[model samples]
Target: MVAITEMTNWAVDLIDVRKTYGKAIQALRGVNIQVGRGEIFGLLGPNGAGKSTLVKIMMTVVRPTQALGTILGRPLGHRGKLAATGYLPENHSFPGYLTGAKLLDYYAALSKVPRSVRGPRAGELLERLGLSRWGSTRIDKYSKGMLQRLGIAQALMNEPELVVLDEPTDGLDPVGRRDVRNLLLDLKQRGNTVFLNSHLLSELEMVCDRVSILVNGLVARQGTLSELTERTVEYEITCVSDVASLAGKLLRLGATVAGPVVTLPGHDIAKVNEAVDCLRSANVAIHAITPKRVGLEDILVEAMGGQDAKPSATPPTSPPAARPAGPHGDS
Candidate 1:
């Protein structure tokens, strides 16, 4: 298992970050999180769960009541370090008049990218994000998928050491989502770190190496994918024949069977071995044996105690508008 080690090289290390609104609304409660270098980290929670508020603090867009930690090895809210970072916030709005290509250049400039590199950087980002053909088209005419791609390109313009994304796949269809997944994987391969927050649990499952689930202004759960899914990880066993007698024996052992298939619903390797021995003893034809992992949504649902709406201790308040580290086009 590849993991970002707990060390001084942590890309993000925010400890006891607390935020409150007015007199009683607590948005964050001692939120402590650590992200490793060159890893795709996913943060998850329902609406008004301080997910947005936490990310805003990272970009220094919203001041936390109290936060003591380091980001990219610098103190929290260190502006000089932000120049090397890329950010794509949720509900990001771009200038409607600018073409897709121009949009990238504008955001890049905000990151303080040199003039010599902006043009080439913008072109390369457009092409990589599959927006090369539509570079000349205005954003007002672009589709939802196109706009999402443009937002990603804008974040990458500076070739940042670390990138922060919030709900990056908000409006994308399946095919477009696949493309985004591929792009994220490519970024990881290039040794850049990604810190992601999204409501789409499946998308996070596909790309995140580690995840933290924040519920009611606190981190309810946090770990690697395998660690998070440890409780419900399952294995499957398949046999070629639908032998009735063997089915009964396996059934008594609590295995689910469906015509030549037996599903052992636990992570125990021994049970799998026991099932295999039973099949062999019964002279049943053995077909295949494999493991099936649980989904992140299931874990999240369990973590939140099966709640459907925002599980907040306080009433909802308007969150800050999503904005990049620099002038992210228009508000």
Candidate 2:
């Protein structure tokens, strides 16, 4: 294991990290990633693309069979640093016999929370996560959303500097998802580092400062959403005339058209002009043209070698809101 010097800066840094499972399953391939303190970083990828493996390596839940990395300025798997970090795995189950309060107490003790502060802290977190009424309920009785909240409460018991959450909103109803988003914002305001691994791209786009996308066991793309997608511009144009016939022509000319609109995919000025010329030549009078901001989901799909097709229905979109809504997330 290589030693880490100066633990005062980055909360997490990966230097050529690699992981392989069994004979041919290379879960991670020579990946290099870095996350600064107090930043919300998202690890995104398709199913089976190593997002979970990478997170497990970071939390020391599974040792990387190859390569190296550091967390909280200590080499990966360092026990001392692990104590200062909290982790919520994708599929977590607490002991069925224990009440929510007891489960938290047990984990807090393991986390070395002071004996005098554990009770109050547990109560505070229960209240904060909307679990106060169910403190005495056994884990077996808790609903999926409640269990998820309890999982988070347990992770925060020690007030760790780095919090890693995988699929944090899975199974959560709209309102429940909104709550988690709000909690993440509060954590950021308090200057804590949040590393999220999720398939929920909308949530990631709203909360993350930077994101890394993995493909075929390697980091295919990583950066701020704006940075990875900065060069791609999509515009939704609506015209009074039914221009559906022109879609095939626009696509052949390097544009994507869906239903009532045609979209130019890149930021090249010439391409935009070319589309305009094509439309004009076809005598298609434009009714409206609005820039369609690319999102984290859009970039991840494209990076994963997936096609950018128009969705079943045009998704209802509002300009980015200042704060993301809770579990019943405005759905």
**Which candidate leads in lDDT?**
1
Top candidate when judged by TM-score against the true structure: 1
Q: What is the C-alpha lDDT of each candidate?
A: 0.80, 0.79
Per-model tally of clashing residue pairs = 0, 16
- Tens-place lDDT per residue, model 1, 1-331, is 0122233888888889999998799999999999998999999987878999999999998999999777787877777669878889999888899999888888888888998999998889889888999999999999888999899999899998889998888899888889888988898999999999999987998899999999999998899987876453455555666856677788876788887768776666677777777887777756555555445776677678885422222111222342221111110
In angstroms, the error of model 1 at 68 is 1.5
Tens-digit per-residue lDDT, 1-331, candidate 2: 4454444477888878788888787888888888989999998888988889888888878878775657888888877878788889999989999999999899999988888888999999999999999999999999999999999999899898999999999888999899999999999999999999999888988899999998877888888866864543555544446667888777876777776566665455566566666777887766555455566666677787778732222242333332221111111
TM-scores, all candidates, are: 0.83, 0.81
